[model samples]
Target: MEGTRYLDSEFRFNSGRLSLDLAATVRRRASTPIDVLGNPNACGRWLKAAGLFSDVPELSAENEEALIRLREAIWKLVTGAMETRYPEDATAVVNAAARFPLGTPQLQSRSGTVSVVSDDPFATAMSTIARDAIELVSGSLRLRLKTCDQPDCRMLFVDTSPSGQRRWCSMQRCGSRAKGHAFRQRHELSVRA
Candidate 1:
């Protein structure tokens, strides 16, 4: 439901990339300029200030760098999607912060309204970790991900199954129709035989 806004038939084959999409959705949702590369600093800072990263120095530094790259990749994908550009993937984004988990050790806020007085390093770390998690989900579900075999209906979807043999984004929609037509052809052949 949250991602219903962006997940269309055009991106149906990306059901495995839903986790990545979710983060994109959130980033876009919180975004102001609306441009793909509007203001990475402002957006990145906002996420960090919002308690999304960790306060540790070494970990936060690594995450910050990864987050910047991830944002750049995401922006490229968004621009590509809008311009009908395909082939670009989300692997870079997923693997960037994949080394570290986002939310570890439950953090608490004892002060007034949980504000990081000095430079909020933790928030930055958390943001990248969040992006990494989405990437992991994308990788895990990549096998099930499918681009509709139909030339016309090239939608994407997660082919959740034991056999990993799903052929269409929706059988009731495209699969059933293809089957019906095939059955009719077979019946006609039988009669001719």
Candidate 2:
């Protein structure tokens, strides 16, 4: 969530309509609205809407068992951005995304036996962005990015700040909180003296 600010609005459709949809899904991590969709939840919805798993009825069966796993994998990838050890392998990344509400994902079998494989179905949907997330955490990926320092806010944002010293997710929201706190502290100190 904290790294989403690094994304570009123009990128929503940059690679075309589908890519734009994915970008929009990824960008939801930065929104603070009542319907703010987190990375995990959005990933699930995207997979179904994108019809990536339609061929396998079991994949979308019984309350979206497969979708849940996919969402968890995505969450891990986003949360891992703040960690010292970025996931090096696809398994690690997939595991991270599968942390949300998940279940046994039954993949279609060529032999007529649906089975769950370590290879996450959602990972295929995420293949487009996993490398970018890894590169970002490893410092190999660079963009005009910044993280909001607001204690209650974990949103990531693009630094459109003129000085690029912006620390809050948005000056209109988190910025006011920081300023109000600083003002209170200054008043308390003056009163003590």
Candidate 3:
């Protein structure tokens, strides 16, 4: 609600994986964290911007609470998976979230071609995210999950690069800041010498 800054374009869809993106809804996980999902409206907007829903759904306060719970569960599960350990209650939470109804794939004809489209935006968004979390933790992609190396920014991401050596949430954001900080420190040290 108050921290609308997180809903800005800069914070949307940078993570290569949707589940990682969801985990990143909270900024600065290590310190001075900001909860981006400050309200149900914010959560609905995030879902829409994430492309999980074509339009923002009307979420109740209970839905907001459930989403926040799921978000924390996802974060714990992912971080634990990275360390080859499962966080206590993480599996149960994820399994419970997965039990939510999922979107039904409906075949529709558009321009004389039939294509499957997802119905029920709310269910689809939640179910897809839950499934993604399960897959990431239980599949080979678990090895690719990483937390940002930026000191104050501990966002999560999937290393999609060919080298799998990515360290920042975004090159233009955290990477540039880190590079500039290193350059300034070097300059200061040379001056002192």
Candidate 4:
């Protein structure tokens, strides 16, 4: 806490879905935003992590720009869906992206491993994410989408937990910190009393 600042070197995949994970690349959009997908390589890393491709796909600056544009549109659509207000532009972007062809999963008999390959990996990844978003919004899981309760987090997530009472994006970070803060405030109030 003294000197080491939090670096945005790695991609975050905690949102539980491809589109949501992509949406999480840029954090705190309302205030100071931290963009984890700062470049094509980062985007490729995230796609690889998402299991979109067996190997990391080559991405260009244009790909990065397109990805960022789609990510923002996805964020808008997701938040709008959460509020029961789907933006026209966002809807169009996601719908168009979803229409793109997805990667074909081939079962390699040599290794018996399924690898998703595509003539255009970028298009495949983008379409896959957009399709996931579409399904998430149109399906029953839309009711479970929730933003993190931590004031500074500004993260969106699905409340898949039993009882559907999940709040923080990460219990170890936001939930624990919030609980500790409340405990400290309560203890201080008791001391004052």
lDDT of 4 by residue, 1-193 (tens): 5311222236667787889989998887657888988853777777777777656678888888888889999999999999898999999989988888887788998999887778877887889999999999988999999998988787888889989999988898789999999999999999999
lDDT of 1 by residue, 1-193 (tens): 6533422321222334433332332222322423322333433443423335323133345544555566555544433433445324544454444444434343356643443332444543534544644544345654444555545554444577789888865677778878888999999999999
TM-score (C-alpha, index-matched) for candidate 1 = 0.36
Task: Give per-residue lDDT, candidate 3, residue 111.
Answer: 55
Which residue runs does candidate 2 get wrong by more than 4 Å? 1-84, 88-91, 94-125, 138-146, 158-164
Model 2 residue 146 lDDT?
A: 45
Which residue pairs show backbone clashes in model 3?
1-38
Model 3 ranges off by over 4 Å: 1-10, 111-120
Quantify all predictions' global Cα lDDT against the true fold.
0.46, 0.46, 0.80, 0.84
Error of 2 at 50 (Å): 13
* Model 2: residue 190 alpha-carbon error in angstroms: 3.0
Residues 55-103, model 2: lDDT tens digits: 3222334334433433344344434554444444533745454353322
- Each prediction's RMSD over C-alphas, in Å, is 11.3, 12.1, 3.5, 3.8
Evaluation by lDDT, superior candidate among 3 and 4:
4
- Against the hidden true structure, what lDDT does model 1 obtain? 0.46
Residue 184 local lDDT, model 3: 100
Candidate 1 Cα misplacement greater than 4 A, ranges: 1-138
Q: What lDDT tens digits, residue by residue, belong to model 3 across residues 54-124?
A: 66778878777777788899999999999999887977878877876776555555656433255555666
